[model samples]
Target chain A: MDKKKNISMAVIKRLPKYQRYLREMLNNDIDRISSKELSEKIGFTASQIRQDLNCFGDFGQQGYGYNVADLYKEICNILGLTKQYKTIIIGAGNIGQAIANYTNFQKMNFDLVGIFDTNPKLCGLKINDIEIRDIDLLGEFLKENNVDIAIICVPSRSAQGICDMVVKGGIKGIWNFAPIDLSIPKEVIVENVHLSESLLTLSCLMNGAI
Target chain B: MDKKKNISMAVIKRLPKYQRYLREMLNNDIDRISSKELSEKIGFTASQIRQDLNCFGDFGQQGYGYNVADLYKEICNILGLTKQYKTIIIGAGNIGQAIANYTNFQKMNFDLVGIFDTNPKLCGLKINDIEIRDIDLLGEFLKENNVDIAIICVPSRSAQGICDMVVKGGIKGIWNFAPIDLSIPKEVIVENVHLSESLLTLSCLMNGAI
Candidate 1:
């Protein structure tokens, strides 16, 4: 656990993919897998997997591979999935509503505690049993709820402002779906789901421009 | 244009961001910007910006800086935005419906032509005026239409099958929302929006595990 703080961003990014594959393996009753086999399945090099896993602690034995269930649990712990996260969506727009309707995040322990939108028509509606409140009440709601993450699905122009509010309300993480980048304090972690950028990347690749 | 074919993936990823910032500048009535000024706005080093732009062609003057509109147009061309793409969603689930409702993609010229779902209840329902079609009819519909992109929003178990069908139907690009890595032919381009992995990334960062 002490070694986790120094783990590289590349390894950090790969952890979720590892977690995913491991979870699937667990579901399929795959009890153990050698590094090479796991690598073949994940498309990562065996040495790379060993090195990444080593950053945290020893897992796999020399001849005996890793135990799938054990690795999945450890990866989940590393991903902070051992504890439930209380989250709120700051926009009740298309993306926000969809996220609110998504049961997968809830299954992964991300609880949607509230939803907020500036539009009056959207304010009173409920999605996944969570009501969409007026944006004006967002600050107060944040103060009342122990929200660990804020899902910003609002328009780009309003994203930064919403981000500021969430940060002020003590949000530690932000899942931003907006196009614009939000400037926040050093402690706040941001994960962007930039749809337009992703689409452009596909188009650029399809165009054979890279 | 030939140089674009050899551009690195790192630079290709950065092009969308440059396009976005330039478009914002254009919206603000900013006609031109020096690399230094752009670097300050975009958070990239001026030298990096100059180098990335130099991949396609010479656009910025030695002293006068880059013309915003012209640079935006060039970047769009490089991103294949000069031509419109017909897109279809292969699942009418939460994410699929949200993408269909998103008008921004249409503004960017990714026209959502059809939506498909295995669920009988979802079929024939309309989203953004495009009626959702039965999955059974997807193959025939693809043959009849010129679809440039297939947005896969199905569950992991069904993703690969849907991918195979779309590839057979001649899709050049895939925007996958499922949490599975798709196997595709070399000519096909795939861009994934793995929300679960992204959320885990945020949690890991917030957990200080990396």
Candidate 2:
């Protein structure tokens, strides 16, 4: 893709917030929304909202504003939510098993295809109908199955090795729960899910820093 | 705090990123970091970093930069993390239990005081030295002991009720793991940990939207 067509990360980051608001509107049966109304609800300025939406295409009109469903669908398409991504969890620990049980992922079109664990006892265990497989089979499994994302639930020390293995197996994206940064190729995207960061943000706010 | 002293949310949001990089530098035995070096490591501009740090207090000098350990400690102090926050997990399900097992919180000084679940069977189960208690005692527990933060880890359907109960119990901050936006009182601060948003972010980037 050309540089002009490559959406800015700032705008890309706002997409999820817009999507969340749109999802709420869709649920409430609010079929349409003006940039002003969206700004009121989401705290972004109308002009900023308009500019961000305009980056994608002409979704808004002069008087009718944006059709909530259509805008939501467009956002889903842009975010790849319309496509089903086959995913695997690298660890069968609490964090891994918890993610396996998260239904929101399925709603977002992330299909959990498999779960892998190093422990032999956990291998045969079932979590939300998916049985955990031995970590030994992860390489062969990735080689055979169409796995798009690798959810790293392992601890910090083991996370890099898992990332290397997953990337080597041709996985394109990583959803890392590990607290460490993973060094991967530019072609392979990694999203680090650090829960403590959010807590720290809240902590700072509560500490009168905000 | 007055308007001039009230840090913007944008700056507040960047605190965790700065803290993460600061922690990394300290770990590497890097004693000091210039704004230029920090900007390179954390992707923020040098001036932006300087402004953010200046919002709190003077940390940088003319030639010598910020002392890594002191700055890290300052960040911890600003984040209210230097003080131990008595925390409770509201659900003993997969997410809650997993969070109870998370070692990162203790390192950040958020002590997990108790674990509570509505299900009677889960009560008394131990997760990392903290035994799960009946959800019924959450009110009395909060009344008797000090709880600075309440982690809402129940399902979306039950998250609101739990939030209301926790807020009514006189907690200050919430670390919500549920997939719902909670309607909370103005006094209560919430940091919604929506894992799916992060997933969608990665999805968009992978879809070449970024």
Candidate 3:
């Protein structure tokens, strides 16, 4: 049985939060936790945590709740984060560099393998010791290096062109920071992170509405 | 009588995409459109469009489609985009500067009124002519500038402190780029943009199993 069928994307996204709280509990030697206690720690309702966890096989007893270490391993297995993922950033600009320098990526499963930028002047520049290569050599680099994922941080105008190159280079998934909407083939999965959209959502919330 | 009563956060997040497609159609002089047409353009199902729009009201006829302009106005009203939001950013780092340089924020109904950073060297620096102010002046700046929304692009270690300051300064909403889990008082609302989480999800998809 494949691991993907047991959980949805929404559930997968929440696993990290669950893991964090569980890890803290484990470190503190809190072996057992009720759904209510887990809920309070992770900010989800007790019922929601149970339902989300119930999607997988039964892990918790009726009255005693879940064991911290056991629950952590279950969630980690579901999220596929037990193993590390080799990742490469495509653009070494402000956004790209910030992503490269971010410590969370390292703490998470991602291992930064390489960074690429279009500008010749930026070639050989190191962000946290990861050297930048010219974008022109992307195909050869992908072949030589086992880069399975690409983070697209290029400008909107150049996003599609770079996406095309990345797709051809056989990268399967992309985290797109470009503002424009991209259409990739069905085989390639693209997630658009429009920072402006997120900011606007916060603005709407401030206005006391949705 | 309020827009908040009918829409969920998930539905609200999709409004920008709908508005983008509606604007494109309006520019092309597309006067009338069905939920099906809108769905096809935005890659959502027609039933979802109808269901999401139905929450606001029946804007379309039973058989015929919807008037593009009318639907646009309805979505904008529901999203509270008809009113402008006075926004500010904290931390003038790479992420902060990139966000300030982004032109799309101005295109939306939100305006970047000010920026605050603790770095003495960055206090006088400007991006898009918005000067970075000393973080010590945050409380006064929020009050005097009528700033309602804040973007926190500071380091993870400093995120909680800045969030506390923003809340105390009377800012109602926060868009947090830092990966730390925050605990805010009941009145303050926060949206965490976990960048590495996005990267990890992309990695899972690339591996063909999560």
Find the candidate with the highest TM-score and give its number: 1
lDDT per residue for candidate 1 within B112-189, as digits (tens), equals: 999999999988889989999999999999999999999999999999999999999999999999999999998899
TM-score of each: 0.96, 0.89, 0.89
Candidate 3 backbone collisions, by pair: none
- Residue-wise lDDT of candidate 1 within A80-186, one digit each (tens)? 99989999998888899889998999999999999999999887889988888998998898888899999999999899989999999999999999999889999
User: Model 2: which docking level applies?
Assistant: medium
Off by over 4 Å in 3: A1-6, A27-29, A120-124, B2-4, B62-64, B206-210
lDDT string for model 3 (A1-210, tens) is 454476678876776678767877888999999999888878899999998887766877999999788888876665567777677888887789877887667787778898999888899989889899998888898888776678888988799998888888888778899877887998988877888667656655655644
DockQ of each candidate relative to the true complex: 0.77, 0.63, 0.49
Question: Which of the numbered candidates is closest to the native, going by highest DockQ?
Answer: 1
The lowest-lDDT stretch of 10 consecutive residues in candidate 3 chain B is B201-210
Candidate 2 clashes between residue pairs 3 or more apart in a chain or in different chains: none
Instruction: Estimate, for each residue in B72-165, the C-alpha lDDT of model 2 and write its tens digit.
Output: 9888887887677889999988889889888888878888899999898889889998989998888999999879999999888899999999
| Model 1 misplaced regions, further than 4 Å | A1-3, B1-3
- Deviation of model 2 at A80, angstroms: 0.7
- Candidates 1 and 2 compared: the better one by DockQ is 1
